[model samples]
Target: MMPNRVIAIGDFDGVHRGHQQILLQLNEWAASLHAEPMVLSFDANTKGQKIITDNRVKDWYFSQYGIEHWQVLHFEQWKEMAAEDFTDHFLKEELQVVGLVCGQDFHFGKDRKGNEFTLISRGITVKKLKSLMVEDLRVSSSMIRTYLEAGELEQAEARLGHPFCLMGEVCRGKGLARQYGQPTVNIPLSSRQLLPPYGVYAAWVEAEGSRYPAAANIGVRPTVESGGEPNLEAHILRDSPDLYGCEIRIELKAYLRKETRFESREQLFAQIQKDGEHSLTRLEMLK
Candidate 1:
């Protein structure tokens, strides 16, 4: 007999609302069959390619939604693996997956040969879900990425069912915010991750199980360093937890303004103060 499982296989890039739908159905099936909900996903990000969700954050979200078994397939190792080997060796022998779920557009294996029929041929049960629609738009990762690239945050968030977030370690900064006395956690943007436009945003920064409203800047310090890696600086309203070297997750709740170079430090400081107040007001509305 096959080991009990309801395996949902896909890139599941964003785990957007549509992806959640498949996972939710898998949950119901797993509960009914007394099986576990398992997810098999890729951990690769192509160069110059943007994704709605980065792999690190995606992994955490998967666990939060009750996925018991998580299998991350390294892109380099399995990129050339055949569909036959994938089923016989990986799924059958390795995972012992008895049931499968995926979107209608799901494709996998070498040369993108695997499909719904491929899994069925291996004698595994398969469920192919249709893409979900929201606001007359097909809720999809690619669509959401487009919205983010264009800085249409609210539209992207609507399809995502959550705010667009950036996750990184709070690195040491050049001590600009300290001059004003409130601590700002600086997060370096990874080249592997997708970025919204360089701008100021009303955000929520989460650290060590607590979330704080913040005014954040997503850009290199154009005023200070003419050229620098893209960095995200979030000034948590009324809280500073010695976040240096700490990992923090900042969700872009709303876009506030485009990043601009000020003629002087005084101008920048004044604008940041206004941004902090506006960010607080926006966050209050979220509550």
Candidate 2:
């Protein structure tokens, strides 16, 4: 016979701290009933535009949280199903979920007609996680995304329970920054992912368990030349080692300013010196 399962359901776009709490509760409930923990989430790629995180990031986050069993249900069929039918089919027949955990604002089923009350009436144990408040505001993925787009890294980090991070592998670049004495490790932009505003930022870069204070640039390299693909380039402070072909994670700590172009190479170098000085100051403050 299949093992009993305590199921948690959500889109979990960014899987922020509030979602972490709900997952913890689901784990606890599963342990109490000797059941396995399962996450019922939608398949990102299969859903196209509505999908949130790419599969790689989502899998990494869930795996880090010790979630071994994930049921990636297709949203197309269930999108129009009624609450009663969803409960009867996926919840009751397919998963045989004994306990459920979700955020207080979560809704399910056709027209989003499902609620905590409905789940309780169906005889399933239910736990409603309260919204996490940070600095008198509700912590949410949308709020974090807003901060990211606005280049408010510090505010976004507080709500995220950690720094906002972008993970990618170092790739080849035109090495234009080298001409200005500001060499950069370039990361290609992805259409499926949301990036912080085009700016210079104070960031902590992690590679192979090592972290370094660095300055990051996210844009189309307007200073060097315009009409190029967007890229993320990090210049590690006081350290210039080979990082080509290495996967790195950049955790943004604070926003410095938007990318700007200068009239001449000499002027650009001067501004870079200033950006470096400001980045160092911000790093010291973070420490």
* Candidate 2 residue spans exceeding 4 A from truth: 43-55, 71-74, 178-182, 265-270
Please, what are the lDDT tens digits per residue for candidate 2 over residues 1-287? Answer: 77878888877767778878877888888898999999988755332533334555566677877889887777786788898888877787878877889887878887788987887888778888788888888887777778777777787777776777777788978776677777777767677777778888988788877887788888876666879877788888777667889888787788898888878878876777788788889999998
lDDT of 2: 0.78
Judge candidate 1 against the unseen true structure and give its global Cα lDDT, from 0 to 1.
0.83
TM-score of each prediction: 0.94, 0.85
Clash totals for all models, in order? 0, 0
Candidate 1, residues 1-287, lDDT tens digits: the string is 65578888766777789988888888888888787789887776422266667777787778778876778778778879998889888888877777888887777789888887888898888887888888787887888888898888888888888889878788898897788776689977767677889999999989999998899999887887887988889988876778888888899988889999999988888889899999999888876
TM-score of model 1 vs. true structure: 0.94
TM-score leader: 1
Residue 41 in model 2: lDDT = 80
